[model samples]
Target: MKNYTTPILILFLFLVIAIIGNITISAIGLFFNHDVFNTGVYANGYEASLNIKLIFMAKAFALLMFIYSVYILIRNLKFLVRRDFFNNKLVQCFSKSGKLFFFSGIVGFLASICGILNIAIIKDFGSQAYLNIDSKSLYIMLMILGFFLLLFSKVLDKGNEIQQENDLTI
Candidate 1:
């Protein structure tokens, strides 16, 4: 229990801001990039009209949810300092965080899969200015970590019950 609230809070906020920025840019590019779409990125007559904006937005959405789960997991750490180890809120946080992380990871990975299935011309891979990077490996890690956290939460709940019963006996 290193009291990781502050750092995690900062990370959550940063991820939120990044998601907002991504959505904003994606929406702007979708709604208004007509001026540049035909001339700039579509240089080779690759007529993939179905842009991958939705996939990009989907990844952003997943990242937002993933960080939000982490935010919830760390939000109630005050109970840990108070030596209240058996609080239901702590268990609930872990449970909810695990579920959300799993869901987010699945969504992100599926989005990537869909993106890959699309015609490559639907999105410009080389013309991006470096900020449009998305990582499949990251999503895979999220899925694995989420599953472990879920199992850990169950173990923690059982331990909490045992500790409470011992306390009552004394």
Candidate 2:
């Protein structure tokens, strides 16, 4: 069995907070406005449908993805901070993880946005609008994950540079 350290505890806490926040926001939206669903068509005559519950769910799911991404971010950040934000083992881990997290976050964020927009459009123009809810939601989640990966990669590159410099000095 492995022992849980402070950093792990912090990571766990962050995840809980993010997930809770996402769920809470979704519930709030669902509760406050239950009559926001409708069906409509756009200028192109495409069909679309929007439901309050769906919108809430999409947003909540996106937020959950975002939270996971953030956890990766915080993990890297914690490492950087512990390493004094320099080139070291912990920082290296952070740098790598941070990029991964950033990409994930971006993907999730985009997907969430797309889902939200789709719901909004369907609500206004009718459910016959031109957008797929399930697909968009998936993209949003991917976007979140992608964003984290991007960020982590960038940071890791920087860490590598610093490490090289230190090696040269030694």
Candidate 3:
């Protein structure tokens, strides 16, 4: 135990600040019809429409979920130093975070799909000011990471069972 409390707290605070900033930007972009945070301006030179709003809202929801998952994961890291690597609390933390992230990834994936389709439809008529920079790969990567976390949780759960059994026998 080399005392990771300080470093972890620092990293957590930094992440919280970044998440807050991102959420604020998303909110501003949503209310002001701005093209910030990958809202993606359309052929009309702005994101001032119902479809754009819906897509932006979906992305915002996903962003919140993703941030929350990370927060939970980081907040429950005390088990690392406590030598309680196979605890229920840690497993639940990972499991819940993994599920939330996976759901968020799905939502983001759908939003990206809708955005691409919208772009395709608009571009069919003409390609005059359409600028879409939304990365579909990002959502896919999130999904993968969430799945890994879920598997990690399962492994930890099994380890917990083994540790409990060993303790009982001793």
User: Candidate 2 residues 37-129, lDDT tens each?
Assistant: 332223354332345445545545555554555565555554554545443554445444545444544544565565566556654434312
Ranked by TM-score, top first: 3, 1, 2
TM-score for all models, in order of appearance: 0.76, 0.40, 0.77
Highest TM-score: which candidate? 3
Over 1-170, each residue of candidate 3 has an lDDT whose tens digit, in order, gives 53777787788778667666665665566566555544245326654556766776787678778878988987787787777788899999999998988898999899878777767775431221122323578788889889999999999999999999999999
Give the top-scoring candidate (lDDT): 3
Worst 10 contiguous positions by lDDT, candidate 1: 124-133
Candidate with the larger lDDT of 1 and 3? 3
Q: Model 3: which residue pairs collide?
A: none
RMSD of 3: 4.3
Candidate 3 C-alpha error for residue 8, in Å:
4.1
Count of clashes in candidate 1: 0
lDDT of 1 by residue, 1-170 (tens): 55676776787788778767766665555544532323355454433234466666677788888878877867777777676766878778778888888888899898878777654644555323222445788788888888887887788799999998998999
